[model samples]
Target: MLFSTIVATSRAVGTTRSRRTKVEELRSLLAVLEPVEVEPAVSWLAGEPRQGRIGVGWRTLAGARVDPADAPSLTVSDVDRAFTELAGLAGTGSTGRRRELLATLLGAATTAEQEFLVRLLTGDLRQGALEGVMTDAVAATAGLPAETVRRAFMLSGQLSVTAAAALTGGADALTAFRLEVGRPIRPMLASPAPSLADAYSRFGGDVSVEYKLDGARIQVHRHDETVRVFTRTLREITGSVPELVDLVAALPCTSVVLDGETLALDPAGRPRPFQETMSRFGAESAHDLLLHPYFFDCLHLDGVDLLDAPLAERLDALQRVAPEHRIPGVLQPDDAAAKAQFEAALAAGHEGVVVKDLTAPYAAGRRGRAWQKVKPEHTLDLVVLGAEWGYGRRTGYLSNLHLGARDPDGGEPIMVGKTFKGLTDALLQWQTEEFPRHERSRDAHAVYLRPELVVEIELDGVQVSPRYPGGVALRFARVVRYRPDKTAAEADTIDAVRALLPATDSG
Candidate 1:
């Protein structure tokens, strides 16, 4: 198929807000792809290339500009082959080699196709072609149910693979996806609850309240002597976390899949700051900052699959296999008892608690209310220093806010962090209209303001960050509301922001 066909569909999907229209556009595109083109086309439309990060950055793309070809002749296979070659480049002269390849690729693409290729390479192809929408489109094209497609994706942990299966072999191929022992599956997700009372009220007494650890999520898969650990995003980090690999390999069973959290601990046994735990994940070697695994659910044991089993049965399997590593929790607790567990989790320097429905099966890759997380939310009034140009659905609006904390001595608002979350349509429109009035400077990416607008920001907490002048940054920060009643000088100070960090992390 022509690459222009995919670009046109991507544009159509992005311009429309209607989910049905987006799905239809994607479905039409998917239906026409040849067998060899299925994976790359589906992946590109989903805003990810099957080759996965070809090391091309905006700078490289910017420097290697070629005039567009007058006609559209590039095929889907042509682009895929170029990306595959790019992904294989390494070591000396790879940069020059990549530039030459990009130049050749762009030289053959028309203007629209060139734009699409640049966005695809830079990881900015945010059309409404999300995984869910594409999953529906794949199912529609293949005459299969959406649930079947979703299940296949969740089990395989790769939409490209799932799309290929559905296109070639139809329903039978999709249902064949199972919890393979060595392959990583998407971990189940939890929804946020306002409070423990709300979570307990929703699930009644048949729930397990477990500590929501302030650590990195890990899914460990072991088959005999080989153990592989994957992050929440399914990135394999087996070499980075040898300790976890060894621990999962030592489980009594020959093959098992465990879902859990891992964090560094202080000498006194309290959980270390979350950043400390995440730092080890990026390192090639295990550091002095060792991570201890805390198993929360068992997805597979020996030859049996517990993915279809209820939480009770999964917990039973977890208890039998890795009782020593299971996360601290109480099963079937009442409202008051669940509240106590929440308090205990907080007291242990962990994130609050996850109240899980004991009867629900593991809804992998889905963030449903079957598991509700209740955490103490903190809010701060901060100054909006600038705003960035939005893309996709947020096009033409000033979306991401550059937030700053007040300097008590009145020097300047110190830069803290940026957050684009929690902004509604009304807020987006209001900011687009109001922010320019306070604009001090402009750039290609952002409009810098006078730091005169105070906005209320809700956050999970704060962590030490050398990235900011205050040496701390807000964690999971989102817009609450614009504080029209407050001024920038009256916004939360740098000292106040630093105080929000945990005592262990504040230093």
Candidate 2:
């Protein structure tokens, strides 16, 4: 298929706010794609390339200027092949080689195609066509149930792969997707609760209150001698975390998939700062700060898949496979007992507790109310829209951060408020060095970003405001930390921010 078709469809999807219209447009596009072009086209529409990051950035793209072709002649395969070559470039002259290759690819495209390719390469493509919408489109085109496509995607952890299967082989191919012991599936997510009382009221006594640890999320898959560890985003990190691999390898079960948290612990067995734990994730080896794994949920054990099993049964399997490493929690606890567990988790240097419904099956990659996380203080993972230059001793650094909440309706992030509090000198320096890479536009007071970075912000509450488009502003907002594990799409939504409004002033 021609690349221009994709550019036109993306533009059509972006210009409309109706999700049904977006899905219909994507369905029309998917229904006509050639079999060989399915995966790459789907990946591009999802804002991720099939080749992953090709070492291209905004600076490199800016320098690769070339005259555009008058007509659309480039095929989807053409861009894929060029990106493959670019991703393989290395050594001293690789930078120049990448620029040359990108220029060659862009020079053969028209203006519209050039815009799409640049956005795709630089990770700045923010149209309404998200993975969920594309999944719905795929299901619609294939004449299969939406849940089937979603299940396959959750198990495969790649929408591109699942979409290809659905488009090519229909229902039978999607059914072929299963909980493979070696392949890492998407991790289940939890929604935030107002308080412990609210969680108890929702689930009654049929809930398991588990400690919500302050650490990086890890998913370990062990099949016999081989053990692979993946981060929450399903990126493999087996080599960086040997301790995690070895720990899972020693489990009595021959094959298992464990979902849990891993963090560095001080001498007193208390969890270290989140940054210290995350720093080890990018290292070649488990540096001096060795991470310890704590297993909480079991997705697979032996030969049986527990993904469809209730939390009660999954916990039983987790106990059977790695009882010693299970997280601290109480099953079916009374209100007083659940409260005590929540306090105990906080006292033990953990974040808080997640109250999970005992009867609900594991909903991978879906953040639902079946599991609700309760913390003592209100915290939100918000997008960094822009940052202002610092003053006083912090001069020359990006200080005040303009925060935004993710739009649930697939639009631009909604601006909530700004803050300069809780930023240490080290954080300020890091912001100055890092924020420019995501720059969209700039002015004398601030450098606006592409709404890509997710930062955890703590706020007392929110109040009605006309200063921002969201009609709400964060109260006493301050930076808790930058959540490298999360994507901008996974940040707390505008509805969540509005849910924090004062009771009498909810208007």
Candidate 3:
């Protein structure tokens, strides 16, 4: 397939408000791709590169200047090979070589293809129709059930590969995907609950109220003597924390997959600051920080796949394998009991409590309402669109920030508000120096970035807005911290912002 085909399809996908139109746009492209080219094409159209981060940075991309070809002639394989060569360069003189490679690739591409290449290489493909929408497209093109496609996606954690299997091998091939002992499946996620009383009222009876730990989520996989640990996004970090490896290997069961949290603790066992935990969690080598694991749900136990089982059965399995490590929780309690549990979690220095339906099966890769988490304050993981230069005492630094919420339909972020609050001298200095590296285009007041960085922002509430693209604006927004572990793809959506709007309006 020609690379221009992808660029045109992506434009169509991003411009529409209707989801059916987006799926059909993607489906048309998927139907034409050969099996060998399926993965790269799907990955690129989903606003990601199959090569991941290939050492290309803003400085590298900014330096490349090439006159694009008038005609579209670059094949999908041709572009993939060019990226392969770019990714293979390293060490001395590698920078210049990468630049040469990028220039050559761009020179061969048409104007539209060049723009697409820049966006894909910079890791800021702003087009909507991410993994979720593309999954439906795959199902549409392959003539398979959407549920089967989604289930395969959750189990494999790679939409590219799932799409390939479905297109070539069909439903039976997708059914072959299961919770393997070594491969990490996508973790189930929770929606926010307004309050404990609300959660109790919603679930009525037989809810598992558990403490919500303020730590990095970890998924541990053990097979015989070997153990592997993965983050929520399914990136392996087994080598960084040998202690966690040993701990999971000691579980009573021979083969198991445990979903849990890991964090550095203070002397008294209270959770450390999120930054401190991320420092250790994101490390390449072990430091003084030692991480401890807390098991919450077991997906696989002794060759039995518990992902289809109810939460109650899964919790029972978790208790049997690692009784002491099970997260503190109360099952099937009254509203008062659940409220007390929530209080206990808060008093014990935890984030909050999660109320879950015991009978609900684990919905991997789906943020369903079966589980809900209650917190003390409203926090949104928003993308940093850009930042402005500082003034007066804060001179020579990037102070005010332009923030945006993710467009749930998979379009570019919708700018909601701006903030200059919640910065220390350290952060101000860091942003002033580093923000430029992400700059897509700049102006006098602000340097607009490609929207790759995710920051946790605390806000008072949201209000109607005519200026912002989301039709709402944040109230009293301030940065809590930068989330280095998260991606822009994972940021909270514009729908989440509008959700905070008042129930009734006279307008």
Global local distance difference test of model 3: 0.86
Window of ten residues with lowest summed lDDT in model 3: 122-131
Put down candidate 3 lDDT per residue, 1-507, tens digits, no spaces: 888888899889988877789899999999898888899898888777788768986678778868999999998999888877887889999998998988888889888888888888777684432777888889999998899999999899888899999999999999999888999888888876656787778877779999998888899999999999999878899988899998888778899999999888899989888888778766788888888888899999998999989999999999899998888999999877888898999988998988999999988877688998887877888999998888898987888999999876677788999999999899998898889878888878888998788898988888898988778888999889998877777788887777777777313
For candidate 2, write residues 252-336 as lDDT tens digits. Answer: 9899999999999999999999999999888877687899888889988988999899999999999998999999999999989
Q: For candidate 1, lDDT tens digit of each residue in 1-507?
A: 999999998888777656688889888888888999999998888676898888988789988889999999999999999999999999999999999999999999999999999877765563221676788888999998899999999999889999999999998898899989878887787766656887888977899999999788899999889999988768888999988988887889998999999999999999987668878888888887889999999999989999889999999999999999999999998777888999999999987899999999999987678998877876677889899999999999999999998755333578999999999999999999998867767999999886668887989888988999788888999997785534564576677678667768866
Best by lDDT: 2
**Candidate 2 lDDT (Cα, 0 to 1):** 0.90
What is the lDDT, from 0 to 100, of the residue 59 in candidate 3? 75
* Worst 10 contiguous positions by lDDT, candidate 2: 123-132
TM-score to true structure, per model? 0.78, 0.95, 0.95
Q: Rank the candidates by lDDT, best first.
A: 2, 3, 1
- Which lDDT value does model 3 have at 450? 85
Candidate 3: count the clashes.
2
The local lDDT score (0 to 100) that residue 2 gets in candidate 2 is 91
CA shift of 58, model 3, Å: 3.6
